[model samples]
Target: MAIGDAQVDAADLETVAQQLGRTPRGTRAIASRCPSGHPNVVQTNPRLPDGTPFPTMFYLTCPKLNSLVSTLEGSGLMKEQTERLAEDPELAAAYQRAHESYLAERDAIESLGTQVTAGGMPSRVKCLHVHVAHALAKGPGVNPFGDEALALLREQALWPAGDCSAS
Candidate 1:
């Protein structure tokens, strides 16, 4: 699959389901893939087939990555980052831009008529998973916190060394 490709095939869906350990609802595309060509991030619809509004547009699917992010989250990274947002004006501005960009992208797909973007953007760091997924899907230099989280993982040698698709 190529970047920004909206097509979601059956095999990819199956792989995503296996990664998630459940059926993925409102997934519109495989947003990003791991080195082994497995869906690591997914672009989801603003609304589900059942007409339920879903705010998260990009979702992380690789179990290894998910677990790694969870570990980071468990380390109180989100709370620390949220505190930094208040003291760091530049980072706060960049995060606001990220939030706006996320809203625009999701609104383009289908508006949920709300300002809510995922991961508590614009003011706080809520979920590193959403940030990492956004960073992977859109590439580097978009989400500051996401880039920071990935850097932290790399610096700590916590990043997965093998194919993360195999779980």
Candidate 2:
């Protein structure tokens, strides 16, 4: 699997489309991969072909990871992280940095004309999926809350990294 940069091939796009139940719009490249060499994360364009403002730069396309994140959200994990953000200074700072990094990446792709990055970054943790995608795309130490959330999933044996690709 390519570690950081992966050209979004037709097979990869097809795989992501199947996983998501629809063709992804504005997909620029695969940002990360699963252990079995399938794409797990993708970097999207700020603007779609239809000129829609798609601010979400990095997106997770792996069905297994998406399911795990959905389960975490169903379990009130997002709320817990939001509360923790208000309480932990270091974590809040790191999350803010993640927000900045996300903006920089998106800006590098196209001027999106908005400061609001995905996953309720810098202020709240509304979407764990986006944060997890960011962490997977940018790697660890970039998104602290994402790393923590992924750690929680791993701790609970909920992470489906390698097994999904086998299927």
Candidate 3:
């Protein structure tokens, strides 16, 4: 489907969740956050203080929470296919291809790494959530991932806190 045509459905999420052994609550939560409200992706700015404005912002409507809903929602494909792969080689191979897409996206965003603050922002980009937030709040120059960006970053170690100029 075209990116615009893509959507996150509660039932689809449930099916995907069931395949991965996640609780219904988890699936629903994921659905709630990404709820197809926004259209475009977000990004961060080049100059953010205290990481305020997240150094990024997206034009799309905001998701429901501070968490990385996009990543969770995107993972649906992998979760849905994992079980099928275990039982069917063809399905598994297909799932692998889908998973490769997900991983490539995840890796590409992770590579952006919260913009590094040009010598580290006064606040620092600790935690993937914060980084993503910063990226989204600031928009563009600072962080490329935006809200979706932080969701990916959250899986890694937090950004160290300190002054960039001093270091």
Candidate 4:
């Protein structure tokens, strides 16, 4: 489910903390949830509470999804996607748009005065976890790499197999 920057309550924060194994800093809202209605993606503040510049606006918090995305990253998918970005102009354009969109959303919340978006966007694929989180939070077609990663996960039968809520 898309939570979309709505006010997060104590239970949600507690769940996010459990998922991260620490208290989440600068969490503005629960961005998205898994099939079991547990927060899988969170919309974070552009600048963290401690005055740190946080470029990652969308963060994936689901352990199951994190593990699966890590598997994809370990398989050198990032390198392949990065290479494709150099060769495919259309893809590069789409990815640029995604980066711009991410920046606009984050800047709307709080401008960090930087063009750097998360997950090596518009140029390379650095983290599938971030990409997947972006796709999950914004839905498909927003981020090409993100959409591709989600599709690959689904094709591999590694996504939506069951509830991913923390026990």
Candidate 5:
């Protein structure tokens, strides 16, 4: 069955490879696209082609977006999010739902046994990149923290508005 509109082709793989500086592992399809029609959020397999165990299901491959998320990470935004996870009960429940949602998507592709959700979901927020990727891949309302981070990115004008997957 086709996964939405993102059927990964050779060119898409090459573009992601160029952006990552290496061949991405377990990438199955483009879950979300950049505004410029480039692969941004990718759906990855729980296990890679070479038998590597990858827990990250939705992988963000766009270099521009990745760089922007890295900038947010450097600014201690993740810590703030993590603190909010404890300070707000509703937000924490929503984050847990996001964690379950992420796990369900990954299990649909391939079961990974462990429930090691990415970005410190249902608890802490270690990586804004992972949360943001989750939000982008799954769309809005699935991951509240990810959505909040994306909103901040948009507000700060840090979201990549151009293609970052050009080879």
Candidate 6:
């Protein structure tokens, strides 16, 4: 394993070793035979029911996992906020007030809809390239463009540490 790789618990490690007819040390020796096979270096480490380690390991790009975790965490936070707002009478009243105001504004707009238009016909215009730049960014989990440009950016960012000079 690398100097600071994530690891499964000792109990899980022992269980995996036992299932394979080997000691925990032996299993770790085999699994960590190389940095590539090490749990810390790898993306995933499986454990037995009792939280023992398993032989097989799976690897994935860390940035992808980071993006997924961030998105899921945000979703969970939003869910909690929504639930709390639903259960709070003060918040509910505020929401109801806003809802009524929105409805009144909508009705006013509808009443005037026919008066505001292009030659008596309502028309909608939108800005071009509104999201173009945003869509261009290579965010976490996004490996677009085959990582070449991103690798260059990464190198430029690292500079002396690892060639992180921006492309």
Off by over 4 Å in 6: 1-73, 111-167
Residues 1-167 of candidate 2 have per-residue lDDT tens digits of 23124356888888888878898888888888887778888888888888999888888888888888888889998898899988989989998999998998888877878898998988998888898999988889999877987898889877754568655
lDDT over C-alpha atoms for residue 29 of model 6? 19
Per-residue CA lDDT of model 4 for 1-167, tens digit only, reads 22335578789889989999998988888889988998999888888878899888999999998998898899999999999988989999999999999999988988999899999987888888889999999998999888988899899888877878743
Cα lDDT tens digits for candidate 5, 1-167: 23333467878777778878898676778778898888887788788777788888888888888888888889888888888888899988999999998888777777878888788877898778788889898889999977987898899876755555442
C-alpha lDDT of all candidate models, in order: 0.89, 0.84, 0.33, 0.88, 0.81, 0.28
For residue 69, give model 2's deviation from the true position in Å: 0.7
Q: Assess the local accuracy of residue 129 in candidate 6 as a C-alpha lDDT between 0 and 100.
A: 13
Tens-place lDDT per residue, model 6, 63-158, is 222233244335453344345454776644543443343234323423322222111011111110111111122122221111222243345443
1-167 per-residue lDDT for model 3 (tens digits): 11122344555444434433452221111211222332112232222333333222222223323323445436552333334445666544543443343334334433334433321222222233333443443433443223334444445422111221122
Mark the regions of model 5 whose C-alpha exceeds 4 Å error after superposition. 1-6, 165-167
lDDT of 6: 0.28
RMSD of every prediction? 2.5, 3.2, 18.8, 2.8, 2.8, 22.2
Pairwise lDDT winner, candidates 3 and 6: 3
Quote each prediction's TM-score. Answer: 0.94, 0.91, 0.22, 0.94, 0.90, 0.23
**lDDT at 107 for candidate 1?**
93
Cα error, candidate 2, residue 126 (Å):
0.8
In model 4, what is the error at residue 100, expressed in angstroms?
A: 0.6
